[model samples]
Target: MNTTPDSIRHVALSTVRLPLAVPISDAKVFTGRQKPMTEVIFLFAEITTEQGHEGLGFSYSKRAGGPAQYAHAREVAEGLIGHDPSDIAKIYTQLLWAGASVGRSGVATQALAAIDVALHDLKAKRAGLPLAKLLGSHRDSVRTYNTSGGFLNASIEEVKDNATRSLEAGIGGIKIKVGLPDTAEDLRRVAAVREHIGPDVPLMVDANQQWDRTTALRMGRALEEFDLTWIEEPLDAYDVEGHARLTRSLDTPIATGEMLASVAEHERLIDERACDIIQPDCPRVGGITQFTRLLTLADRAGLDLAPHFAMEIHLHLAATYPREPWVEHFDWLDPLFNETLETRDGRMILPERPGLGVTFSDQARAWTTDAVEFGIR
Candidate 1:
């Protein structure tokens, strides 16, 4: 096993689209209204090495606009064929800039994200090390906070019940959705959840960009009694000035950047002090390459880095950067992968296996209806 640079031979990219239909729990609705059973789609990326090792990565997206994502994955994969899979940063930048004509952010970044994760997995497999080691190991565990275990659409009893279950499960903190019909209702929900979790456990609220500046400020003021850990995306993602104003006006730290697509946007947020925490998602922020850069920017700005989602990948990044407070927890999409990461007592144990230490399950791949293999030549 001569694991030298020359041992890396070839790379290929392929996609499998998994279709799912799941019920929205009482605690997971938007605007206090529960929608009917909705279809969820997940995209999987497979990267192969000449040495016969392979790795898988995935992204979760709503079903309505999935074809666009599939197309974007194919377009980005075109640039990955025949390249050295070990060069994660180089390949990431190629796909990132390739779609510059269409815009560097959004779908382009997501496409790059999937490929980047897979390539890292491939590299890890080659080196016989875990992704955390490949990324620069620090702590073997990362803290996690519950997301959407408490819903705005649920009754007060239901909300409390779910919050209780989440806390009992060992989650250090819980995040609830707010900003539905009115600010008053939002305040009530936050207060109820806070009481359910008690004073010791941390609580956070995500508005999902549902409120304007005035309403956000008003709600932020009202939520003060509940002792929120952070107020997430209370205003439009692009409204940097409004975020800055909201940050200054509120006692709670304003948190955002999940919707951001590039390091430059994150830098702008940091430069303006628009948020106390920067949440860059691997799939949304141009993959690990950009995410590492964003962490650097956060370090420079004296800000905290709490990645948006993709806990498995975020765990590696969090371990790499000990300053990150927490990684979001959502288990809905875990089954779609071949190998899944585990969380115990509110802490994620970094995968010690090489690469991502996870693979797509056969059942998960069976759910993929449209399978497209790129770079067939």
Candidate 2:
């Protein structure tokens, strides 16, 4: 399966919209009639070589811009059509400069990320190895923390039920959403979840950057008794000094960086001691090429890795992290892909199949609003 730039022939972009099982409310967005945040936008890319090999990858945004990401991916595809997928760094650099004017963080970087992931998937498949094995695996299984059960829109009873189910199904860590209007209610919910999951299991909370310096410190102190594993994004993503202050003031580890766009930003967080646990989302940080760089940074800084979302992509990358990795668990994506990630003894067992070990489900294809191609004859 030798492929060169000449052998690389076609690029395709598509989109699918999937409704959430239950509408999720975070600190910022509540999904109701006026807000109407029901469905998520999925933008996908498919790369095919002259040898007839294909790789699949996708990216997402919460409520807007499925078409924009798809358009950007299509625009990026023009620069990629004649380039070998094996030349990941070369392609990534080309894409970076291609979108330099747009500031390369939000949609531009996300588009590059989609292409990078598909290239890796294609390379791993050609080699007949899983992506983790291709990257080098530190462990066969990575520990998972369930996030689906803890959105702000869910009731306390719903949260408790979700936590119980996650534990009963063998996952050991549960993270719930905090940062509601009332800090007392937040404390109460955390305490209830902690009690329900028991004394030994790890309980974490995400404030989703909803708090200021003072509120974060107050809530961190109030919920300290519950023995949270970490408090996520208590302050705004860019507030390095505030995160550092909260990290120093609290006994529980401060975990942030899900929203950061670049390694330099993460370096600022690390050098400033902004967080104890560092989380990098692969798609958000321009895919594996950039993600691996961040992993090395976390290793040197002696920080633990807990990647943000899309466990399908993170689970493999997490296996290679220097420290024990905590991969987030969200079932919202289950319907979009064909394969199911297995969780046993609170750990995700990596799939043995080549590449990402996934393809779009029939349901996902049915939801696709559009698909277009470049370089295909």
Return the TM-score for each candidate structure: 0.90, 0.95
In candidate 2, which residue ranges exceed 4 Å CA deviation?
1-6, 30-36
Cα lDDT tens digits, model 2, 52-107, are 77888777877566677778877767888777678889989998998788876777
What CA RMSD would candidate 2 show? 2.0
Model 1 over residues 1-377: C-alpha lDDT tens digits?
Answer: 66644323333434445433344442224544446335566566786655566877766554344556667877767676667677777777777677778888777677667777777777777778888787786688887888756555467787688777766776678888887756677777777777767897888888878788888998888888888889999988999999999988888999999887788888889999999988888777767777888887788788877788778788888888757568788776666665666667777778777777776777776766676665432
Candidate 2 lDDT trough over 10 residues, lowest sum: 28-37
Choose the strongest candidate by TM-score: 2
